[model samples]
Target: MKTLLHAAGLAAWLAMSQASAGISLNGTRVIFDGAHPEASVTVRNHGADILVQSWLEALDSDKAELPFAITPPLTRLPAGQEQLLRILYAGAGASDQQETAFWLNVQEIPQAAGKGNVLQLAVRQRVKVFYRPPGLDGDALQAPERLRWRLRRERGNSWLQADNPSRYHVTVTGLTLLSGGKSKEISRAQMLAPGAGGQWPLPADTANDARLRYQIINDFGASQAFEARLQGVAPAQPQRLEP
Candidate 1:
């Protein structure tokens, strides 16, 4: 499966927790249907009373105003149960391949009882909509024009580094096992720009038998696959065992 790498600035706010009594949005993800995009908003209640609120704003990728807002007639979310708010873009005139941002602003509501309201709050979330064209297939990769990798061992720790000095983005998608067999994918990522490099931390228990195989995918629907062997030994302990 493919996942979009979130821009650096937006990652911080998306990781916040909203389990408190005040209004908050959590577990937000964008789903694109090629023609229309849907933003699912979940509002959690951590207090004793129900939540009644109104419209929220949605923005585009450039931080511009989207012509849509999320205003359900009656948003009554009971304590602990989440309310799923769906915002559709069917009527909104937009392109399929273009990327846009959807921002949400949650309004606050006053408490029903005579006591002062403590549930007044506002939260924002963003979603990117992109179109996925058809006729794409997955296949094994060929070697790239240039390939370089390194393995370094330290005190009970090792590092694996890979570099792609070519002019295309590379995808590493597979892993090889240590016991003369292949294993399922452990991790995958795209390497951007020429001269870009990445480092992977190796576990202390992994000895000379461990190995990793990776594939490099380019933007033009081509890929390169290779393997890297890792040799490790346990860090020497100062004391010897008594027999």
Candidate 2:
């Protein structure tokens, strides 16, 4: 029986996550600094003959202020081949106070096979593109440590509130709240916007004083762990874990 997978799989992938993709990016994410003329990333194809189309997309609701230009937007990628995607910055119009975030979408176009019942599929991958402007206020690495946390209870619901006061985006990858004897694990990656505070609902919270262990993804996309004592007002900042 002939099977169809191109549209349905692509739609499901867009709504959710996929186990794997036909093409892989060399880096986890891309960082385009304002001081540099451009940035590039390596895209390698698996054992599939497909067309790779890459383009920059705006993450914000307003799309009038884009400042990036991608080269080789559409190219034919053979089996087990690789190519370099160059991202040239316009060098203007981005905010100088805070880092801007964008989405780089790499989509795979499936080629037809000369068979009777072939399962054709197309895959897509998205990576965060962080554009750090020149003369930013704070360092990207130190932005995680500057965060403060406190347990907020409102309307019979307990939430872990995280306050970020830095100019760079801080992505929280792992979190665990430990009480006297019980521990609740929160395993989700959430990006805290610059100069903003966010709250995540807690499964349970009954400790008088708890230890908050949180992990953040750094500039290179590596997870680093940190811990702090949860307070009524978050007096103590997060301390980095010692290697």
Best by lDDT: 2
- Candidate 1 lDDT over 93-130, as tens digits, reads 54332333343555545355566743333433333322
Q: Going through the candidates in order, what is the number of backbone clashes in each?
A: 4, 0
What are the RMSD figures for all models against the true structure?
15.4, 4.9
The candidate that achieves the highest TM-score relative to the unseen native structure: 2
Runs off by more than 4 Å, candidate 2: 1-21, 60-65, 203-205
Candidate 1 local Cα displacement, residue 172, angstroms = 19
lDDT of each: 0.47, 0.83
Off by over 4 Å in 1: 1-19, 22-26, 35-39, 52-65, 69-74, 112-243
Taking the tens digit of each residue's C-alpha lDDT, what string does model 2 give over 1-243?
Answer: 124577777677655434445689988899988788888989898756789999888887578757788889999998989989999887677888898899898988878878597556678889999998877877888999999888877776788888899999899977888887888887766899899988878754456488888889887878899998986545558999975
